[model samples]
Target: MRSGGLKRLGLVSGLLAGALALSACSTVGGDQPQQAGQDGGQNASLATKLIMGTPNPPPLSEPVDTQIKRDCPPVDVLDGAAAFRAYATPGSADPFDIRYQASIADTARECSSLGVEAAIRVGVTGRVILGPKGSPGSFRLPLRIAVVDEKGVPVYSRMHPIDVTVPAGQTQADFPHIEDGVVVPIPANRFRGWKIMVGYDPSGATQTRASRAR
Candidate 1:
């Protein structure tokens, strides 16, 4: 009986020792990066690019083959055009008549030169706030994106209607608006006060909707 008990104890000890050795090999310092990766961090980097409103720029280590002599102008939201008030009654000026208000929160743009013309992608980040008469639902916000010269003349303009969906329990909704491939003649100098403008244009949205209705 004593011999059989000792033989069983020896077998158990061997198994435990092998398990410890295998575990130590798996946890070696050299394999830390691989072992810790939850699959990999590549998806996280991609998500960061979306939040940044553009693709990741080339790494500094990678030399540029050709550099375009151009610049991206600053984006602006004008005071009068930044906000739009939606009222229950058309053409109503009463404060109590406001159903909701949509406004621009931020803007960004990127520029690339295509030989003669510069291609730009402008982005507008905005929010819709609930007013006295507003309720949680979907809303269409009219966005006007334009490139204006120093004299406030629009060199290029485009109308973009963004959909904002506020959840059933939410009082507001945030939306991202991007207008891509806006081509313009390359300016002689980037600092010539060219402006990328974005704003709420209810008239433009209304006209588009009216046309669709017809």
Candidate 2:
């Protein structure tokens, strides 16, 4: 590669890194809804219709643009619950028994600010990497999307059951999940402190078949 090409590559990488640094919260992003707030089935584009792992949870769609919407809450991913690691063994760290690992790559949102209540649409994008013991097949990717006020008060939170499939001959792919119609009532003075949060929720993950190595 030429020096100019190298510089261009470096610049692109730097730009990408800088975008992910938008906040100390949200996007290592992954999750599940406990009680349904709104059925995303209609507006969910790639949830069950996508074509890529680095992009699917049975989820993930295209690469999400981290751009924020005006008059709307921003989407965020929790740092601690960013990635989901599944082991072939019940509770062992043996690398050979590793199944697959999934992570949140980006997030986006659209908020409705015209009425006394706000409706927000949140989307999460990510990928899955197959491990040594992992195979090309369907796997569960747990995720949780939550909402909170600016003061850190809980507004809406739920777990969403998401999954991704590893197609034949592919070691990995992309996934994108979008939840639509998250409505929150606006208070007096029109103070909007709502934020959409996304992350990996292991508690909602399906029980994996662990190896005897445990």
Candidate 3:
């Protein structure tokens, strides 16, 4: 009877020890820290791009005299017969806040009998916030400009990238303003009408939703 009791006591003690060892191993493994991610597992920053305008193309098959009259109208003709210019703005009064000034010149001297120059001026200005309404962080934005014909075809394009940072839970109302202009010269004796298109990367990565300067 005494020997049987001793064997039973030893088995019970051994089972308890094994259970404690397994629990300890599990606790250690479960508590191990994981590797940090690139963003430190934090939320990503907000990004956006400005939208540009559509391209205005020159009139086709119009008589030289008529084409000149329409493009280099007498109202804003810089030169009596050789050159003309105009201006346009591409943004409104909401979330998408920006403007642009552009110029187009008619360089044809033989077609108009008078030297004519056509120019379009655009003015672009705006502000953008990078972080969430309350939490702010680093961000990247891209801007682009393009020249298109009346048929909505791209003739010339240019892009510029900008990087910015904002403070946490603060509104970034003030931003860098853009006051850039483009000049296009029409070849001599050419009678073509053209339009300029300005656009920005809406995805904050690529250009989208191109708009025309008014």
In terms of TM-score, which candidate is strongest?
1
Single out the weakest 10-residue window by summed lDDT for candidate 2. 1-10
Taking all chains together, the TM-score of candidate 1 against the true structure is 0.67
**C-alpha root-mean-square deviation, candidate 3:** 30.6
Model 3 whole-model lDDT (C-alpha atoms): 0.27
Sorted by TM-score, highest first, which candidate order results?
Answer: 1, 2, 3
If scored against the real structure, what TM-score would every candidate get? 0.67, 0.63, 0.33
Per-candidate RMSD vs. true structure? 20.5, 11.7, 30.6
Give residue 23's error in model 3 in angstroms: 59
* Runs off by more than 4 Å, candidate 2: 1-69, 189-193, 206-214
The residue-by-residue lDDT of candidate 3 on 1-214, one tens digit each, is: 0111111111121110011110101001110001111233121110001001111112223344655434521111122211111112233333223221111111111113244444433322223333222225544444454555445455555664544444566444222313234434444434244443333444333332232122
Candidate 2 residue-wise lDDT, 32-149, digit = tens: 2210113432222221222111111232232233222234565666767777778888787887888987866655555555356766677665667788989999887778888888
TM-score: model 3 vs. ground truth: 0.33
Model 2, TM vs. native: 0.63
Clash number by candidate, in order? 0, 37, 52
Which residue window of length 10 is worst by lDDT in model 3? 24-33
